[model samples]
Target: MKAEYENPFRPPYEFLASGGMVASGLAILALLEENPLPMEIRIGAAAALFLTALVRGRQGWKVFQKKRRLTRGKRFLKEETEIELDDVREIARKNPKKLWIGKGFEWSSTHRQLMKEVQDNMDETKLVGPLPKGEQSKYRETKGAVWVHGLEEEKNEKDIFIPLPDLFGHLLIVGTTRAGKSVFLSLAIAQAIERGECVIVIDPKGDPDLRAAVERACIAAGRADQFVWFHPAFPEKSARLDPLCTFNRVTELASRIASLIPSSRSGGDSFVAFSQRALNAVVNGLLQVGTKPSLIEIRRALESPAMLEELTWKALDAYCVSALESYPSLRDGAYQANAKSKGGKRSKCDIVIGLYRQHVQPSKPNTDLEGLISQKEHPHEHFGKMIAVLLPILDMLTSGPLAQLLSPEYFTDVEREMINIGQIIAQNKVLYLGLDCLSDAMVGSCIGAMFLSDLATMSGQRYNYGTIDDPVNLYIDEGAEVGKHIPFIQLLNKSGGAKFRITIAVQTIADFAAALGNKDMATQVLGNENSWIALRLRDGETQKYLADNLPETTVQYVMNTQGSSSKAGSTEFDANLGERLMQEPAELYPSAMFGKMPTCEFVGNICGQVVKGRIPFIKREEIKQAA
Candidate 1:
């Protein structure tokens, strides 16, 4: 007997079968006209047709489900096991591969539970914390500040978050050039300003990116009046004579160089002790002569044969006195004393000092020295509230004595004095010093390392009295170039307890890794970062780094397929004609394919929730026009 005929109308197949039924209905209509069928028979036939169609439709649906299962089963299963951000208790980027691509994340069960807990408890007020007590009587603030947006995409983007409550510590950001580092920094600055926090930016290059952002943020936060600019104008002479003024200009240079010398180079403590004694002797000798001499004058006096022959107490005294006489304040020992006094009090201006050797150098040595003294005497006049020192790394390295004096061990007393001055300036106010023009890889690293070490020491000494509740964020652009400084890396990666947050930016992983000195350390720094804003990084190594460091399952989802496919098949059956031979097996498959898309993931409470997006790069003109 022939196999029981199955209902042909089924989903996918149903559409085809329905067309055949319509033709059959037309045939029935024709037959009815020729020989009208009984109403009962017609009803029975109609009912049977309906039942067959229903069965066919059900079967088609089953087939469709089976086809979908072939492709979606694994994905659906994986998604079931995937964890959400809110559920994450602990998050870390795991690197199974040496390269950054194909990195994945390992999460604990606690992560999910904690995230759920956080979500359940989330309240706008709680997230932002209560406004300062006094502000309550002012007005009922209902809305939360939204500074950034649009980071929910699956692709990496350049965006970062710095939460206020979690910001009472230090931070270090490291990335290669073109790595969307600057954009990340901008986010932090914007966030701090929105929260009514004070920020001082020092842009030595005079690029004004940070400065402009700070200004904008201030305006947005209704604190525009608080923004201050402190750029000192150097006389033409100083700009020309930049090399010679090194001896008479800034005192902090010496101190920084001295500090860097591995004590061994300078004969350890003994060398420092000797240097101090020599400086004292020089000072005493000048005092005895009743005349003040400038550094140049003193050097000239020392060169005389008569002074050198005897090297007597009387001769030394005369030389010292002559040098002291040039500066009236020093003649009476008041200059040093006054400096000490000024260093003690809090500075009134929000200072942003710009130190650029090329700009300060003068044509004439005498004129330059005079300008230096004048600037020093009236720092407030030139640098109002903020001082942004734009030091020219190239000029300082190539033309000035600073190149030699930068050596820690060989630093002259004058150089040491400059460093001390820098320390004093850092101590007295809320300061952000940006070292610009640090193009040299080695110098960039050295300066980065030295600045942090010195800053930490000074801050530590006055920690109690000068604890800046307002966190200070350090924005280091081109971090990979400056990554040569191991100390800088160490400080940034580890110095979180202090109210210093380091934000470094670079273009690529290779640059960053090279600057870090060791692959392990580079990994540590990148891994420790609480938040990562991945921009378009097409390099295989970078991609691999992300793959190895981000969640594997998440990466797979990001890499799913999208778009269509087709297939054909044939089936054979035996028919009654000539022992029944029939063959018909045709199939067509059309489906969409999906692969990975760019994705970004935020990991730690330290960074909190991140907001990532492209912000309009507003120039000063644009801002003014908007105003």
Candidate 2:
């Protein structure tokens, strides 16, 4: 491929040629003055010089115009750049396989110079021009348009794209609220949908525009049936999803629910351990009784002694029936034990317990059943107190529409079709899961956490045994709201090989720290993402984080010095002119520029290439007919 044209940021050769032509013309005139010549010959020579000077000057003027046009900063004054579906189709048609990043040119040395020029010329006070009496300060951020909205156009300014394989490395998008994070996400999600990739969006604090964009993309792709909406707020329209339905082991079910209960700082809280153990026993008991474990069932078993007793008895009877068939002689002993246990006040659990000890425990040694019996025999009040931290989490997850949504009845008929992470991945469906965090934060957080757990579990299964299939694009917006769970980090760490491309958007680095409860862990999570896109950021630490990640460039500047001294009526003057280069020890993209970025503009390090780009707001419309 031919090298792309790049401006050297200096005067072109045409200026030098113009200067030489004028110099030659002047030298000829000087020689004619020194040596006599015919008037006609001198006039002819003068005419030729005049014509040559005019031609050179015209060529120089053209070059100057071209240079000014190339170097001039272009600003997008409109807050949004709207693009129709037809434009998207055209771009897709041209680049059949490229993953569209956004619309802009590659970040080059020329752009760097342009950015520096904008910064050097920046006058913050002048930016609030012609503002009303007291509103100047309110529009201070508008000053950023000098650099944020400023873009330089080159020949053939086209859609910017990164390689499709780069997406598997995952992407992290950081921006403050209303900083075009949603617009970027919408464009990305729509493209993924158009690619027919399995797309999963986990949105905590849902945005309707994001959801509509995905839907329209599906419609445009002729794959509307592949779209599945799962929102806690709209149960009637939302698809039912059972987060607990895809666990391989019963203990996994326990761990999924237990993980939501926040652990103490020491990581050795006795109550937390007890709650996990309790969950394990309950899950085991339910599985043994041929009943699938669900949040409501676990909560009920923990809250009610009668439910635990019933499950324990059912498991014991099932074990006894199987054992009795294998060992016929134990049947008479079991009957005799039950006969001895019969009384008005005596419970059937006591008889089952006696039978298990006499017939099943000695021969088979069902430790799982023993744990269940122990939990049932434990005092209900004490057990509830032990799992007090666990109940509210379960209650939040299984309450109201969530009860049916999270714990869908698999065996029985239900109005909404049940979907699992595994099936969604297998079928390559588009799933939009809205947690509605604004309405009920605790419940929404739990639901989002559980969904991440489910996705993590699915990723593991695919990693261990399943084939590497089409890429799964998972977008988690406001990731800090639900990323408290360990599975989120696990998903980031291990999901790459499983062909899972995870894109996470967060408001700031501190949000991750606050969410994960550790600054280092937040760093670890952010580290997993190979690509970083930064929009408008107002937080100090987040700015520092982004600045640290970006590689530095040598910024060039000119130095001018002059000195004059007069002593004892003798005057001396000296002047010096030199060009100097300095290394910016800090950010390649200035830290302060982060806060001033326009809504739809972004600076990103995508696939090892730093890019300054603008993402247009995608609209559902056809190509307009030309008049």
Over 104-149, each residue of candidate 2 has an lDDT whose tens digit, in order, gives 7666665666566545654543433464577444432333454333
lDDT of each: 0.37, 0.76
Ten residues in sequence with the least summed lDDT for candidate 1: 586-595
Candidates' RMSD to native = 19.8, 6.5
Clashes of 2: 0
Q: lDDT tens digits, residues 140-207, model 1?
A: 22221110111111233332323443443433332333333454455455444444443434343334
**Alpha carbon lDDT at 471, candidate 2:** 85
